[model samples]
Target: MRSVFLALLVAFFATGVAAHVARSNSLRDEKLTFNPTNVHVKRLAHTPRTLTNAQRLARGLNPARPQLRSSRRLAGRGGPSLTPTTTSTSTDTPTGTDTTTSTDTPTSTDTATSTDTPTTTSTDTTTSTDTATSTSPTPTPTCTAHTGVLELTGGSYNGYVSSETNSFGEYSVTTDASEALQVQYQECDGAVSYGPINFKTLNGLSTYPYLGGIVGFSSSSDNLASNSPNYVYLGGTQESAAGAPPQRGANSFSAASGTAKDYESAIWSVDPTTGAFTAHWVNTDGTSSAPTIMVVQDAIVLTDDTFRFIQTYGDAVIVSLTFAESSSAAVPPQATSSA
Candidate 1:
């Protein structure tokens, strides 16, 4: 009887150990990919190197359909794209063949320092004028060990603001692991710390169309009660509101740690020819408190005639990515250290 009982116990322990090891191995192998979801990819007609607009017209062909709408950029919920063993893949629906109706004056102002540069290629009907200049600065907060990426456990994080004094709806973002692009944002107490009021124009590529969104974060010391763990939040884009806030606002990204762990994001928009653009952000989560700023650039088609609208934003340290029909990136002016 004793020997039989010992054999049963050994079998059960072995099974449990195997299961635990398998679970750990599975989790440890998980990673983030380079593929982006929710991305409405458009394939514009390819333009061969030999062909120029003037040459096409000279050959008795119509000039490329002129690209109308001004220019903008698409900031992102960017991370390394995940190349799936099997794979998968937003915006308005403009009917009929992609068309343009204006001329473009060429200029450039983007600097890609250890970041990506937008690549633009439009069809024969469109005329494109663009310039890109990139510079690399030194790396900060450096460490000797270059540990490669380990795991990208996509999940929810709350970014709140609760100081020794008061707290407000800070930035927060929630990302799903299964579907990378399907993200939802939330703001708790009302207007975001730097949302809505002070937004900026989108900044990315000049030719390709793109969507815009804002992601925010902050650190919390405790719940409303004043003692617990810190949390982060990646809320949705700010809506247009009543009183006009600064195109720049104030946020500390803290909740009583005597330091800073918070950040704010305000998005705005502009037009194709550099004019004012407005948007009423009907957030995915049912809030129409304020209108969000939205600027649009020349909508471009890819080699396959796919379409997208591009936008841009100010360059603050980007915490998370926001998504919207039309808006710009928010680069918060440098915040002073915690006092």
Candidate 2:
């Protein structure tokens, strides 16, 4: 019985050992099948694959053992090689168009020096004869009682205070007739400044023609000498004329500005018979003085009763005469009457 049991145990041990050995051999076969070195391919020859005909022609070299380009060619530093085996030939010739270049130099010189400084001198010079002046005494007009008279009220800016008449039978005047014919200047606040008076004669009758002209003074042969109308100019201003209150009675001569002084008056007349013209400039200050500086002109008569009477203040034409007989006359009369 002991020998039988020992034999059975030995058989079991041998079978177990054989099973373990078979599992070990299977694991070793799997490890060998998955070896990483199996994928490595070792080169046997030095040459690469055969080159195509186009590749060989493009490289200009034999297909067998073709030479590689140098590093300079790879870096685009070398020009194309002109080998004998190359079928294509090329040559480069530089070309350019004609060019022109030009330069200009300018030379100029401009110099200015202040030889004399500009001056703001008054145009109203003492030697200026624009206004009538007296070198001798002037004879004053004799005072006479008249009927036909025109009184032109002249004050500051308030209002006119005078009478209007076409004949000497209307009123009477002595030496203050010039004051009664006073007129406020067009400027100076529209007569806000007290202006001087004026004296005028129309036909043979007494007439006060201030801003406008008179009519019926025309006669035959009035325009025989010339077509331009006869004109009379009176220039000057009263210093109290501007910015002065209305003071109507003060006539005679007063303080004035510009070239026009006190009693500076002029008269221009045209003969109705001969068509002749004359001017008389007087300093109405009752002086028997010869007009040394008379800026007068001899003009021909224009239309019948049509004339230009110019009154200047400073350098401006403040008033002009007009005739109602002519259409071309400027600033025609406000009213007209017969002589």
Candidate 3:
């Protein structure tokens, strides 16, 4: 009996051991077949739930108060409460999810410019010139060519005579035949009468028994007006008829012998109207001589066979005489001669 009890206990132990080994093997097989990639872990925010004082009063509960405990107090009995307290702990972790966003916008800028310019210029010029020119005058001549003829009238020799007659009716004569002797001059211009002169009525000749013949006659002017003074020059041969009574001699020719052809020569300046006369020259001897008279410019020239006399008139009167041989007596032909 006792053996039988012991065998049974051993069998019970062996069964218990088999059941334990099977449960352990099943757990190990489940752990080995599980997929870690298919397992999903959910995360939630860690927020603890709390109640306000009003909520606590509405639920007929007192408000929570802070507890002050001493360091020696037990943690299980820290404070007293008017109501049952409950505590909840969350099992959650924070997740990394980005919430910032990005965007694009626009900006502004400006530009402008300006420019200007100007210019000017000028010029000028000039010139000039000049020129010139010239001129002159002429001259006159003298008239000397004159010709005429003279005739004696109302005299003892009433005929044509050889005499030099000037252009203005004046003539030189060597003799006068009557006291009333007159001269007539004729030319292409006209004819004129010179004198009805009386030699017996002349001064210094009134006492002569016979008045002498005229030797020469001249005047200061060729043509004179009727009222002008006649500066007349007369040359004379003072004579008495061949055997007349001797007259009282008052000049160098006073000692004349009473003979038929004996004569003395004298020169007189006379006034034709009054018969007044002044004797300028007298022959000292009884010689048959006479002077040829001429008017040259303002002078009276008288030429005789041996002498020449020059008497100038106007402004100042000068008288001069010179001895000259007669050209008619010269043996040689003269280179120059005057008639």
Candidate 4:
């Protein structure tokens, strides 16, 4: 029985030893199979299984490897190289030059002089003498007296003719037995040449009294040659009072002088051809009244009955008539007459 028990104990020990040894071998085999470096090298060197066309066709996948480009070929084609390139440059400087020159010169000269002189001379003389003679006196001047006659065949008028009828011409103011007052220019031939101009028809003359006298006169120096006189002068009193008898008067060289009334007076100029007349002047200025008309030399003179000068009308009042002197042989003096 003791032997059997010891045998059983030894068998138990041997089974434990075997079990440990088997466990150690399993560990060693696992370590050898699972080594990291050897496993990596083996994976690197090991060829992977590839799919065939038939196998790829069966799995619906491409069988060939994908063609990929290189990095440079992917960047661009025929472009500039990425490597940097360098360049070298050079410069040159020039030189300079300068030149100068100058010169100057001057000269001058002057001269001057002056002089003066003068001289004079004079003379004078005197003498005396006397002389005398006798002379005669101057003589007095004389002029020839001229004489002629003025005749009138007409009769009984309201005015007068000059007392000296022998003059070359005569003038009178009268009415020709009509209401119209007439200025008669009587020639030496006993013919009336110019007038009997009706003073009643003239303006301003119509209201006056009967004209006292009329004279045909001119400014011309030659009287007896021309028949047409320049103007005829009429002189008379103012309007007569209501009861006065027409202030009638008549005078002649013969003994037929009649009495009349004279008062305020006026003067008029008359045209012989057309019987037109204008009142040239008036004498109602009462300082001197009663103007009797007459021609003396070359002017018409207004006077009192005594033949004293009252007023001279103008040089234009000279009597001019168409007539022959009574004695043609007698040289006429400056032709004077009166009324």
Candidate 5:
């Protein structure tokens, strides 16, 4: 009987060791390799696997069998809970498809950059264009052209053709016969009547500068002096031969001769021999007054065929006096040339 009891004890010990090993293997499977107490193993070994609790008690064993503790419980009591520390080597294929949806940030940036560049370029272009336009220049105007050229012969007188107050010597006009014509001013103390009026140029008269058109034997050459040919004063007094009273306030008349003399009267007439002529003037004065009349020393017979004289009064040259003639009018002086 004692041998029997020893054998039984040894078997029980063997069963406990087996159970402990089994539990250890199970724990290992669960990744919970925590060691448990012998008492825990004994309890697992005595746990009935096939029979009910009543049957086991009738079999003369403890009414309640020892229960095997779960590996999770054992781990909780002995050490850190070994849940499948399954580092689920989820092949950390970090499926983090680093889907870095890098939105087209550079595209927007490039568009803005391009826009800014064009603005700068446009500004520079506009500035350059404006500079060019501002630096340009304007044009100037020219003078008008002339009508005709003329020559002086015998008889014909010359008329005034400028608004400027020009006179003999400084600027002068003569008859066709080279006789110096004068715009005479007579200080008359009597009532005098004038002769019939005459129109010289095809276009009658000019109202400005002088109210009446010039009355004399004027050559067509003098009419081309300026645009409006009307301002002239024939410095000579009325004579009896011109159907005018020779002297209204004086008894006799003396014509002007010496230097700086003012001829008082003159007469203009058409002769059968001479086309237009100026009769000799009479009654002269040499005094210079506040508003002095034009005085003459001598007449200027043009020597050059083409003569150009600039008539000026105050500021600007009013008329361009140009004289051109035919060769027939330029007769050379002979030994018997008339004076």
Candidate 6:
């Protein structure tokens, strides 16, 4: 038994030596394993007097809440309810083949997203703070095929072409002699008086941030069905109302049907040249106190995608606005040159 014990000890030491040799040889090829991040506690900033530590702690959770990722763009709609404003659109082709809708969602490929919500979460032992910040996103690169690059010589405005039946993923750029031509990489479903609207590809759009359809219903005030492409300002009062004077280039006839309670002043306006809505306005049932909600939609850049411009104005406000492009008539593509 003693001799057997000595032999076992020798075998164990010999095995350990072999294992050491193997480990030394594997040192160069061995992979490093990183452990999970350790729990970290942090101080949350506030107005100092606003939310006390007790209040913050009251909202605290012992174990972190299970996070359900945010809803994706192509997520299916839930059971139907009284959501009259709910619009659904399908994932469109890159060639702009599908007729877009208010409900249709542009695939994530058309729009890249980043989280910007500011939040502070606390637990029994730890606290965390998150903030939302504005940032310009990187521009999407376009295939350098010279399909619809159009340009003109001496014009103050830009232009648009409406012939392409399959323009979903396709983007085009056009310009007058002056400005760099703007391009539309993708089209989502929204009734737009699209006049060379700017889709700033670089730094995500921050300054001139708000983009809208040239002629679509307001997100909130839709029961009134305030459609665009009308003289958004010329309503509730006569062309020669008490406070309202005659507007220039205003529609010659009323757009509404039946015994007109009021002249059908255009609910929206478009650029005649490029045919896009430059401004969005609301008629206040003839109440003459407020001037108008002259929302500046976009500016007139040579690089813009202008189809037509609508001329609209009112007595109190001149409404010197920019325009988008629209064209029901046959439009020929313009010539564009790359630098």
- Against the reference, the lDDT scores of all candidates come to 0.26, 0.25, 0.28, 0.28, 0.24, 0.26
Task: Name the runs in model 1 displaced over 4 angstroms.
Answer: 1-7, 10-197, 200-250, 255-259, 262-339
Greater TM-score among 3 and 4 belongs to 3
Candidate 4 lDDT trough over 10 residues, lowest sum = 39-48
Q: Please, what are the lDDT tens digits per residue for candidate 5 over residues 110-206?
A: 1111132324321111111223345556432121111112222322334332211122212233333222211111111221213111111111111
Write down the lDDT that model 3 would get.
Answer: 0.28
| TM-score of each prediction | 0.17, 0.15, 0.16, 0.15, 0.17, 0.16
Candidate 3 per-residue C-alpha lDDT over 1-339 given as tens digits, one digit per residue, 9 for 90 to 100: 999999999999999999999988776445432111233322211112243655333222346785577668666866765664443333333432222222212211121111222332222222223345554443221111111122222223333221222221122332332212221111112211122111221112212312233212232222212332223222123333322322233211121211122222223233323322222323333232224333333223333421212221222222322111111111112111111
lDDT of 2 by residue, 162-254 (tens): 222212111112234332322211111122111222223222112222222111122121111123222222222112221222222211111
Off by over 4 Å in 3: 1-179, 182-205, 209-248, 251-290, 295-302, 305-339
In Å, residue 11's CA in model 6 sits off its true spot by: 99
Whose TM-score is higher: candidate 3's or candidate 5's? 5
For lDDT, candidate 2 versus 5, the one ahead is 2
Error of 3 at 252 (Å): 13
Q: For model 3, how big is the CA root-mean-square deviation?
A: 99.7
Better of 2 and 4 by lDDT: 4
Please state every model's RMSD to the true fold in angstroms.
Answer: 33.0, 64.1, 99.7, 86.3, 75.0, 42.7
lDDT of 4: 0.28
Measured on C-alpha atoms, candidate 1 has an lDDT of 0.26
List of clashing residue pairs for candidate 4:
148-166, 149-166, 162-338, 183-196
Where model 2 places Cα greater than 4 Å from the true spot, the runs are: 1-233, 236-260, 263-266, 284-339
